[model samples]
Target: MDSAVGRCREIRLRAYPDGMIQPSDLTIIETALPEAGPNDLVVRNRWFRISISTRLMANPDAQAVEGIPFPALRPGDRLADGAIGEVMACPPGSGFEIGTFVSHPLGWRDYAVVDAGSCVALGRGPIEPAAYLGHGWTAYAALTRGIRIRRGDTVFVSSGAGAIGSMAGQIARRLGASRVIGSTSTPDKADWMTAELGYDAAILRNRGSIADQLKAAAPDGVDVFVDMVGGEQLAAAAEAAREGARFVLLGALTAELNVAGASIVAPVQLDSFQLILKDVTLRGYSADRDSAEAFPEWIAWQREARLHFACSTVAGLENAPGALHDACEGRLRGLVMVEV
Candidate 1:
């Protein structure tokens, strides 16, 4: 294996106190690349994905992000989250030889030296980095494995224009759902959901009470609820559920609201008696858990399903901070990928 290496560029969080992700919060620095030791491999990142969850990691409050423990951000810390790259160097006798494509939770950089145990070897599938992250595997897994979506079910998805919501809506359709409804913040997104994404109905959640809007959209009652925004949206979904409905809580973008002055509130209040009467099965899910356990199975299923996803890409490592900023402000639509 080639051991020759030089300097590389990476981003680090300055200080995550509060508010949205500022360009000032991230610093891009050039530093000498560390050589791979035994059981270590060096990767040249090709692409990386930005997620809203990163905002929580940046400025987390104990009261806001309960149960999810992440180390406090400080300057000079390597900001590695999720990255896909090719092995540039590997120790002799290591199974992760050079040129191998792999995915790891070490992003925000052009190069990384990671322990072999920390990376997941990726196959030569035709999957793009954007599709790999944006395809809503978590949403699909939650619907299939967590909710057990039945054929002809009426499905409702919140935040339908976003990555997971878009995927979940289409996947529900592919799974034989009779009706797929989605809620979005804008009319354009709502139109896209119904026109391009094959959703049966789209509700403008930002204009009306989520519960009232859901009632108008799914007048017959929703059999499956895939929630992205928590609080009132969740409460509204629960209110609109039919008997024996399944609720998969994927994200609560409203959960922490942002690390600043926002206090963590139960996006919505659920009455135990109403839940009991409706026979709703509510569960929270993270796609990473399924990926860690059954990634191979996921790949096979994805191939069999032949699912398609949409994404927007930004080139160059220097533009990543701006891309992340766009994501935080809800400017970028679909998956925002940085080509490193």
Candidate 2:
């Protein structure tokens, strides 16, 4: 280990946000790295993901995030998420080599001492390390295991320009969907979704009624709906869904994480009679399910350049809180990452 690598800089919650997150809510501190255990690997974090969930976890009153066992955080607790890093040190039986890149759940710090069992080694590949931080597998699981998109199916993905939504649009096409449509918050994102992400059409959620816009975008109705932004979008999807449509509820960004005591509930005003008549199947996505089955296919597609990785990177770990705030506020596009 380098002499200068002894101390690690970590970000901890200084205070829980009252509503919207402010810079003062987070504080950075320097501490000595804990001695690596016999079965542990010392990793120097390179990149950490910032998502709406980051904001949710920061709220002390928020319910525990399903699938992720980590409890709701309080002041002075360290925040963690999906992070990619290089192994700086490893025990003899750890089955990993120094300089190897791996993905782990310990982030928001310059270094991590994690059990080797918790880290997934990223072997040498043509793809960049940052690409591994994408949410392709999440999208794949929803489209395949959750909804099972069929050939010629028309798929609608809410938050099309977001981390998972960006991948969902392209994966739906690769999975043989004839028409892939997406809904975004801005006209620019809508255009990008169509021009760059291969969406057959993009609906701008802010322009007017999402239900009206979605109905216009998919005039014939959507066969499968991958909804990340709930609320009006869910109702819109329901209204524009064809009979026997499969709907996967992923995230409820419309709930507004900045609001005090935010919960992950998407309050939709849908006609139960219409949903029943259409035979719409609605299922909530839980990350606890095995998504490993989608990894091989997702990697193969990435190797073939069939998927696009989109994100906004912020330099330095200290800026993560602000970046996270931006992500929660929908100010950043795609996957918001902090380069540590």
Candidate 3:
């Protein structure tokens, strides 16, 4: 019990360069127990979600995309990410108590000292914390803010089996989309998307041309596209887009391919004629900013919809590097989580 109540282990980035992330670039350091300040609470992290963009923050060659609020990390800085944790300590009137489940943006560590007001208590529920961290509010935000989901629209989601994509496919159908198609790299993922995730069609990205796959999946064209992997996928989306379609640009999982000299210029190139002639409306999405505005509605949706999200977890603090490496390399599917 004492071991669980005290000091914490943190993963710190030592150096960042382009290409694959090495375990050596990260170092684990032990520190004294984190003390909560006024209006602050200390949480013992239960899970941390590993994402591609979060790994890119540790890459020196990664250029920050405009309008994306990537936390600036220095060599000695603790890598910041999203995690679900339990409040271990809080101020007397903080409204949070020991064992109260909470979520925060500070991860890559065993403990988080987060502002009391900023922390959200998950309360007693069947909703798993890992699910909340992965696709809970983000799924709602993606549908509402990323693009207006009109009833009976044909929706296509890239990276369809991953956290956001999985949720997008289901949510679009719930919102009355006539057909929901997904793009995935593996045959297993494609099967999972169409079978388990309720996607109407699955386009295997590695099997052949993405454009060709999309064309076959939705011959009439997609009315909305939820893009999680930018690059050729984006171009493919444009090619398969219907006239007046809405394209929601969410994540650039492959943007590292364009990283050069501290700049990320035109990492994703879309066909101009397809976009122009189709009169496509492109919108960028940010869960962090959009979530705050939709928090109340998101909470309501969670209860009403009873949505479920799954994660593939890596155990222990030491294995965080391996999880991050897998995410950066596009080797992992769904939400890559770390259980502390």
Candidate 3 lDDT by residue in tens digits, 195-235: 78888889876687988888888999889988877877888
The CA lDDT at 42 in model 1 is 87
- Residue 140 of model 2 has an lDDT of 77
RMSD of each: 2.7, 2.0, 2.8
Q: For each candidate, what TM-score against the reference?
A: 0.91, 0.93, 0.89
Which residue pairs in model 2 clash with each other?
none
Comparing 1 with 3 on lDDT, the higher-scoring candidate is: 3
Best by TM-score: 2
* Alpha-carbon local distance difference test for all models: 0.75, 0.81, 0.76
* Cand. 1 Cα-lDDT: 0.75
Winner on TM-score (2 vs 3): 2
Clashing pairs in 1: 80-107, 81-105, 81-107, 231-267, 231-268, 232-267
lDDT of 3 at 239: 85
Ranking by lDDT: 2, 3, 1
Q: Tens-digit lDDT track for model 1 on 246-308?
A: 998877767544434333454467877888998989988766654446556666666777665
After superposing all C-alphas onto the true structure, candidate 2 shows an RMSD in angstroms of 2.0
**Tens-digit lDDT string for candidate 2 (256-320):** 45265556655778888989999999998853355665666766666775577778899999899
Q: After superposition, how far is residue 61 of candidate 1 from its true place, in Å?
A: 3.3
